[model samples]
Target: MINATILSMFSLSGLNDMTTKHRVTLFSFTLLCYCVILLVNSALIVTITLEEKLHEPMYIFLCNLCINSLYGTAAFYPKFLSDLLSNSHVISYTGCLLQVFVIYSYAATDFSILALMAYDRYVAICRPLEYHSVMTKHRVIWLVCFSRLVSLLCQAIVMIMTSKLELCGSHIEKLYCENWSILKLSCSSITINNIVGFIVIFFYFGHDLFIVCSYVQLVKSALKSREGRKKFTQTCLPHLLCLLNVTTALLFDLMYTRYGSASVPQSVKNFMAIQFLILPPLLNPIIYGLKLTQVRNSVLRLCRCRKQVKGLG
Candidate 1:
């Protein structure tokens, strides 16, 4: 039988190897990264919200994506910054679970939103005539809400199950709290947790497969005309790239968490641990903002408007 007393805190061992001399540099870089993520994502969200031309289904989805990025990073960056400047890297039990919920849910919603984007492109390119009727404003709002709700519910179940476990220890090897890392600490059998975890994984993997199939259809339709090809390159390509980036980042973290070798350098492991949080949030907005003509033009127009206002003042 496991002990009745639950652990109140966990020590994150990922930062144990860092020397004092390197801590300041690491902290500075991380802070700058977080600031940039905030600035770019906020800019995109504001631009999309304010630009009447960007009120369509695609840009609305992009705005939600940026919002998710901010939501996920908010859970990590502040705590991480504080930990970096402090000597100890400890998180409360409740706080740990909350982090798991926010970060993983953020990831799940990312995939969900990407899947929606794929379908949006599929309809836009493959069925252009029906695009307006199909992706109506009401439908777009519902889809966005569905993506976020599904992710939150799934992650909530995972967090609740994890909360019930009787942990054997409080030492987590990763830089941040994660569901799998916490499960590893359980003293009792986690058969139910494992089953539920697999179900969640399978559900999200199905989402990825759906995205792939949508893109396949998109590719087939795009090949039929030069205009279709241009549309796919301008819109679908950025979504594909963002999808690839997030998937690769998640895969690195999964491999490291599940089958990582102790022989690997701690620095490499740390990079793997935080890459998802770093890359997607920082790069996704930039990719869409620069690559998508609509977004680029809207952003430039907003800038010009602000510049003219400043000149008048």
Candidate 2:
């Protein structure tokens, strides 16, 4: 087995699809999208932090969602934007692994946080009497931290397993670094890696199932009362949309990787590859910003406050 440590850099073949002439156009659009993501998520985060009324468990979890979106996107967008201009598309092996860790952990953390939010909602709706005792501010904070820690640990294990592989090559087929791409470069049998991958898959997908089941209970509890119905419509709808968006994006990527046709166009493949990274991060904040009444009102008030100050000045 060749020492995988001997491999230093890996070139990305995914960016080779489009002509160099179109890069500027693509870059501008991508930059705009990223800026919007930053703008919306930051606005939401600031609103949640400054407004004491928004300090409940649900809002705190939503704030964490926005913050995590920023955390996840930062790992990709900057490096991708750089590679957009540069002729060379290579990353150091260590850098590649680090990227895998960040990107994957971010994704895992996303599911974990969503599940936590679902639990928060379930408690609020289904167990209203016990909600105060169950989901204290400290408990929410602790759950947030615990979710990220578990995600990091899970991905850390994957990274370790991937890094130990005796890589046969350095050219990755994808636009960004990830486990499967690195696994493809391996010279050794990846049975253990594959096993760990399955375990992680089951682990995160468990989040989806938990959320769905929570919604089931929530709906049952909601149907009995008018106020419960209103709460479900306003709050749970956005959460469901977010879950669908993330789930769809992930399923697209997963299915394509596992069973997709080789002849499919690179553009489509690129979209599938980045669907989760781009859509959920961008959409989650927008969905929440618009759907949640309190947040919408706060943002409007915030805007008017800024306008008032400008007028006085």
Top-lDDT structure, candidate number: 1
Tens-digit lDDT track of model 2 for 181-278: 78877887999999999899898998999998999999999999999999999999999999999888887887787678989998888889999889
Candidate 1 structure quality by residue, lDDT tens digits, 135-173: 999999999999999999999999998998888889899
Weakest ten-residue segment in model 1 by summed lDDT: 1-10
For model 1, the stretches where C-alpha displacement exceeds 4 angstroms are 1-4
> RMSD of candidate 1 to the true fold?
1.1
